[model samples]
Target chain A: MLLPWEYGVRNLARRPLRTMLTLAALSTVILLVFVVVGFIRGLEKSLSISGDRDVVLVYSVNSEENIENSAIAARTPALLAASVEGTQQRFGVTHVSPEMYLGTRVNTDENNGGLGLVRGVTTGAPLVRRSVKLIDGKWPSSGEVIVGQLAAAKLGYDKQDLAIGKQVVFENKTWEIVGQFAAGGAACESEIWCNLADLQTATKRQDLTVVALLLEPGSSTAEIELFCKERTDLELRALGETDYYQSLQQHYKPVRILAWLVVLLVSGAGVFAGLNMMYGAVAGRVREIATLQAIGYRRRAILLSIVQEGVLLAAAASLIAGAIALVLMNGLAIRFTMGAFTLRIDSVAVLFGCGIGLLLGVLGALPPAIKALRAKVAVSLKAV
Target chain B: MKTIANLSLVTAIVVLIGCKPSESKNENTKSSEPTGKQYLVASEPDDSTPVGEARKGAKDGDAVTLVGHIGGSTKPFVEGIAAFTIVDPKVAYCPPEEGCPTPWDYCCTQNEVKENIATVKIVNERGKTVSEDARQLLGVKELSLVVVQGTAKRDEQGNLSVMAQKVYVKQ
Candidate 1:
């Protein structure tokens, strides 16, 4: 009887075309699974980094994203400051900053047709959050505005762009571009900064909009929430800064779920391909497997050897897929809305994909591997 | 391109190191980062504290104290507690059918009076309803003995009105 390794080699050698086709098909499926996982990983990192851990984002209760839609009457910041029990704020524990989320069109004397998230903020904002960096010019004054990194790129504005100092007109009101900044790699990069009061006038909104605040030491979100409940006229929700961003993920859920659905469908196709190839490979190799059995090969040994070959083939294909994803997909930035983040092909995700592939290979190939061994030795020899 | 990548990597590390300190420091002191000193937990929670009562010491340019969140998107409600200025003797009126209410133009709803604050409804001596700016005139009497603050804007009609920022009950 041939040794176990000898039987595997002879079976694979006999159907070179089928073997190559199965490996290639499996490799493509693994590649797709890796890409989807990579995108999700990159997106999570981008969000956690974009909103600084130090800053608190206040939105109206029951409102998840689009704080413009989450407007708390301009007074919420201070009321929360006074009501949340056990919060520590000293030397003005409350830094009340109003924010307006207005996405509108603006231009430089022409239809530049650029989209912007114009945030109307007060001077107190600079003290509350430290992540907003002004690398050029100065902080926006009452009539002036600051541009985000992405906004600057879209407007062709540089650090020395004196056009910021010059009065530019839009929607009948004149505003000076005073400064530019980068808020990490977050969605804020598409934002425009202006004074809360001035923007109210420019937009003709006399009524105040939502407000944000920073709490000092010894503060808890639960106390603020309880305080909000007592003031039922104003619905309030207080959550930690990290917890808030996690909630923002719900904004991206519909699309992310669609992605996961696509991956599930594609992985089904891979399993189908795997089962078909495994059955065919076993059927075609019955003569060889029976011949080994004819020579006193144990049934368990025959089945185990065939299963190993199947897994090794899938693993090799998966490794190739991993290498491809790492080289071509890394740092491929996706422009989602006004902001963009790179698709990072993380190593841990590669291991996860390959592990899935190995599981599929074992489950799909085992039945076929056992069936071929179950065939009678005399019948197998006669066909050969 | 490679240099940009390297620079970004360094920056990320620096930022990472920077954020850890405050979290760790807070964790060490409070045994939890959730509560400590920034917020004053009331010895007993008081539902009677009008949002303004709790926030009497807020400095300039902060959000006015609100009883609760406004329910809708950008729903504009002149917060009664944060009135920037108070104007009294608003031209309130009883219904025109009520014989013009003896010539006082300002009147209060039962709900308003129960809250110890009346929403000022303004009407001319002839009993014509006016803009909400007239509502501020109602709070003037309520806060004359205390302090109230907010921004003031001229309405379509020229009138001095208060956008109440705060209302304090003076002892």
Candidate 2:
């Protein structure tokens, strides 16, 4: 016969201080699991949602992977719009955008400055980057700029510091923040965007960084690549936007592996902590366990009761940690090399965190409970 | 209650493992079998201009035979099409000590590559480029020396391309 469930629950209350300390320790470990898992999810989501399969990026062949280092002729966009068949078009306008991208020091004030991603784009940018939505104010004109929703967090500044009409200094020119935009949590949300002509004037550049164009439903990326091949003088390379972002995901594989390793290391450490605490708890209860065994309880029944106590404590800790993570870390914007993304405390993270907690409870209880039950019932009962 | 908790624990383990990002799948449409065997010649043309000289002199619709190593960019062959870029043989590959992973790209002489590379496409009677992959059609890979006999097509930008009628792959 099994021990009564109330027996396990009552044992938790018998030693209040030790129980509370164990709960706190378990909660802290589960919270760390929530954070690391959230980070991995956020980074993955940002990259996955950033690309549109129909859009293609045309940049200089020499630039290879880094779009910021790419330079193409200013007329390349016009040429591609005219030459490439099956491009999306409506009302005599083509879905092509010429952009200049760079990383530069952006200063909200004299004291607050950091490396910031900036993109200079034409009106046609919205045509190609369909995910981008202007959330506030109007589009930028000369000497004006627009900040992305997460740009403030990326630049380590308060939202008010980059509010509409506030000035930011970059490229040795002060630009008034005229608008705010969001790109469905894509990396662009961590950049500042401005007028292409204005940025060109400021940076003293005539070349473009890239030309992005959208293709019709049945269109293939091979056609655009063929155009690049045929016009070798242009020195351009075409890549599907989805493939481009997928490549970025591949580039960050090492970081994700390192994150998983951290999760393993943290879980390992938590297991050790749980074992140490359970050993102390079980050592104190040996005589009680012996008394129960003497009163016709099997060793299996006593062990189950001990495990039940541990699992109960862990379940409570999981709830506490999940609540704290949801409140404090969910949607918290964090800066990365590409840009910034929010920590996502979604259902997956919650499930993973709680799973770790329960696993800890089971694993932590087994060895100590087995050790205690192994002693002779007579010797245990006669112990001081 | 114990049974329920065990079940939930198993469910959580399955769900957490399933939480990984789904890999993006590439969709490729296989074209009909190509019948361009006549274009793949058995003998190399004796009078062939170097790809560098052909780029400067070849005109639209002019019959030409050009000889060069099959490479200019990292991906010399276009996907899903019987087309590839050939660079002038005179452009030397980077030495092994340079640690260049793709010497066929001629990264050390990019400017010369820009001037000497010519796109070769095998076209059907409809004047459309063949739908088959070049590697499968020509049996030639990157940096393979070959002779291409085709009609030159020059764009306004002075870029040269060949609508290939025949190709001789050097074994």
Candidate 3:
């Protein structure tokens, strides 16, 4: 027969201080699991969602994967709009955006500055980047710029520093923050955007970095690539937006692997710590266990009660960790080399964290319970 | 009741961890082979022009034979098409000791790469590039020397591409 459920539940209350210490230790470990898993998920989601299958990116062939280093003739966009067919058009204007992308130091004050991604774009950018939406203020004009929602985190500044009407210094010019935009959690959310003409004037650059084109339904990206091949004098390369971000995902695979390794190492350490605590907890209760066995209770029943006590503590710890992770870590902005993305404490992360917690409970209890039960009941009962 | 509830929750989590979402496989849309006469030739064409000279001199619809190595970029071959970029043999590739992963790209000479590379495509009667991989058809890989006989098609901006009729791969 099994031990009564209340027997195990009440046992956790018997040693309140020891139980609390175990709970705290288990909670800390699980919380770390939540954090690392959340980072992996957030980075993956940010890259995956940033790509649009219908968009084709056109940049200089020499630039390879780094679009910021790309330089193309300023007239390339006009040439593409005229030469390329099947591009999305509305009211006689083609969906082609010529953009200038660069990375430079951005300063909110004299002392606070960091490298920030900046983009110079025209009105056509919205047609190609459909995910972007202006949440506040208006489009940037001369001597003004728009900040993405996460641009402050990317530049290592407070949100208030990028507020509307505030001034930011970059490219040796001070610009007013005229607007704020969100890109559906894309990498672009870490960039500052301004008028193409103004940025070009500020940076003294005549060439463009890239030209993004939105294709109409039923159109294939092959046509754009064929254009790039035929216009070899232009020295251009064409890639689907989806394929570009997929390459970025491939580039960061090592970082994700390292994060997973951290999760594994942290879990291994937690299991070992759980084993030590469980051994100590079970070792002190030998007399009580022997008394219970002497009163006609089987060894199996005593073992089940000990395991129940462990699982109860673990379940409580998981609850505490889950609460703390959701409140403190969820939607937290983290800066990366590409940009800034928010920590995603989604359902998957919670499930993984809780699974690890329950696993620790079961594995920690079994060996100690089996070892304690191995001793003869008569000898245990006679012990002090 | 509480014990059963906790056990059920644990069991559910275990089951969920075991269950993975199925991956969606992308369907291959390319046909097995191009619909045309054989594009690979058995003999090398005589009086072949270098890629750099051809790019400068060949006019639209002019018959031309050019010889070059099969690489000018990291990805010299276009995906799902019988087309590739060839660089002039005179352009020196990066040495293996230089730690250049893709010497075929000739990364050491960017300006020369721009001036010496010509795109070659095998086209059908309809003037459309074939929907097949060039590597399989030509039996040539990156940095393989080959001779191409085709009609030169020049653009208004002085870019040169060849609609290839035959290709001879050197051993």
Best by lDDT: 2
TM-score of each: 0.56, 0.89, 0.88
Clashing pairs in 3: none
In terms of DockQ, which candidate is stronger, 2 or 3?
A: 2
Best by TM-score: 2
Leading candidate by DockQ = 2
Question: Per-model C-alpha lDDT, please?
Answer: 0.55, 0.87, 0.85
Model 1 spans with C-alpha error above 4 angstroms: A1-17, A46-55, A61-66, A72-94, A105-116, A130-202, A207-209, A222-237, A250-258, A335-342, B1-171
lDDT of 2 at B58: 82
DockQ for model 3?
0.26
lDDT of 3 at A25: 93
After superposing candidate 3 on the true structure, give the runs of residues whose Cα lies further than 4 Å from its correct spot.
A109-111, A291-301, A376-379, A382-384, B1-37, B42-47, B90-101, B109-111, B135-140, B156-158, B169-171
lDDT of 2 by residue, A197-290 (tens): 9999999999999999999898888889999999988889999998889999999997987787677667766776677778888899889989
- Model 1, A215: alpha-carbon shift in Å? 1.5
Candidate 1, position B107, lDDT? 36
By lDDT: ranked, best first: 2, 3, 1
